[model samples]
Target: MTFPLLLIPGLNCTERAFVPLLGSLWPLASVTLVNHRRGDSMAAIAGAILAEAPPRFALLGFSMGGYIAFEMLRQAPERVERLCCLATMARPDTAEQAENRRRMIALAEQGRFDQVIGANFPNTVHPDNVDSLELRDLHASMARETGAETYVAQQRAILARPDSRPDLAGIRVPTSVVVGEADMVTGVDGAREIAGGVPGAELTVIAGAGHMVPLEQPDAVGEALAKWLRR
Candidate 1:
């Protein structure tokens, strides 16, 4: 019995985030993209996903979605058949990062969302992709779909999430940690830290990619996911 697979997107993202990878593995498994825009906290978001998810499922999460995935593991470890976190960190936000989030929230409230998107783009993609018109346009379109209010809510939720490092040792399910070599936002070191905490977890690094590794290297990501599911 193959488990259902759920994909969770990062900040200001939607199902479109997985579009690049969908064609690569659609027939192998049932894939569902959870809406991360509904809730304002990790707990709320996790709870909502859990409530809608099948009794047991494999989960792949990116960035802010990774934070929510960790909360889901904490909430119900048994229901998860496998877990994968990409371009994410297990540590909670530092004071400075939290303050930055607050500032972004304020800016969003003032309807200056394009400012937030502009400021975030550098961290969201590889430095090379910063000038890539296609990547930039895709990101901008996704951000627009998410809206300013959703962005503010997600930022707050991420800022408030607990440190997930301690919870990792308890993870018995098969796990994978993937990161982009050029990911400045959540660097390879962060993915390494997560893999280290979870015994026997696999780690994959995609060269020439950034925080949005799945979008940039979907075929690589799809192959990694498919192999993990088979194991």
Candidate 2:
């Protein structure tokens, strides 16, 4: 049977962020691209999406999207048949992280959007992929498509999101925590923390990848998702 799959995009990302994985994974299920740019708080955002989501479906959340996924589980655990947290974390943003987000928000508001991404994008990929023109442009495109207002809203939601560390052990679905071995954004240890927190959660570290593992290693991400889908 084909299951419904809801794919959530990260901060400054739109539907394009999952383009690489679509062809490989779409055939296995009916897929939907969530509009994560709507709300300024995690609760509001999660509630909005949950209202539109299928009764029982698989959820794949990346980066800030993972924060929403956690909120979704908290609100309605049975609705999420399976979970995949990619290049994300369970901890609430630290003061330092929130300040950084505020700085980025300021830059975008000041009409220095590209500059904000220029300053931040390089560190989001593997050291080797940092110089990749395609990768850089893809991210820039996604950010531009997401625009400044949504970016600010996403930052606020991420900033106010609850710490999921205490809620991890309650995840009762088949879960997968994936990260890039070289991911500086979330890191392998964070992936391990999520995996260790939930019962029977599998951890997949894509080699030669960074925070953008879904794009940086589409084949591997596809393979991992395929395996998760089987469960």
**Evaluated with lDDT, which candidate comes out highest?**
2
What TM-score would every model get versus the actual structure? Answer: 0.96, 0.97
Candidate 1 weakest ten by summed lDDT: 21-30
lDDT of 2 by residue, 1-231 (tens): 789999998987888879889887777879999988777899999999999999999999999889999999999998999999999999876777789989998998898988988888887999999999999999999988888878888887888888999999999899999999999887788889999999999999999899999989999998998888887
Candidate 1, 1-231: lDDT as tens digits: 545899999988878888988876566668898877777799999999999999988898988889989999999899998999989999877777788889989999999999988888778777777888787888888999999988888888888789999998999889999988898776788899999999889999987689988888888888887777787
Cα deviation of 18 in candidate 2 (Å)?
1.0
| Top model number, TM-score | 2
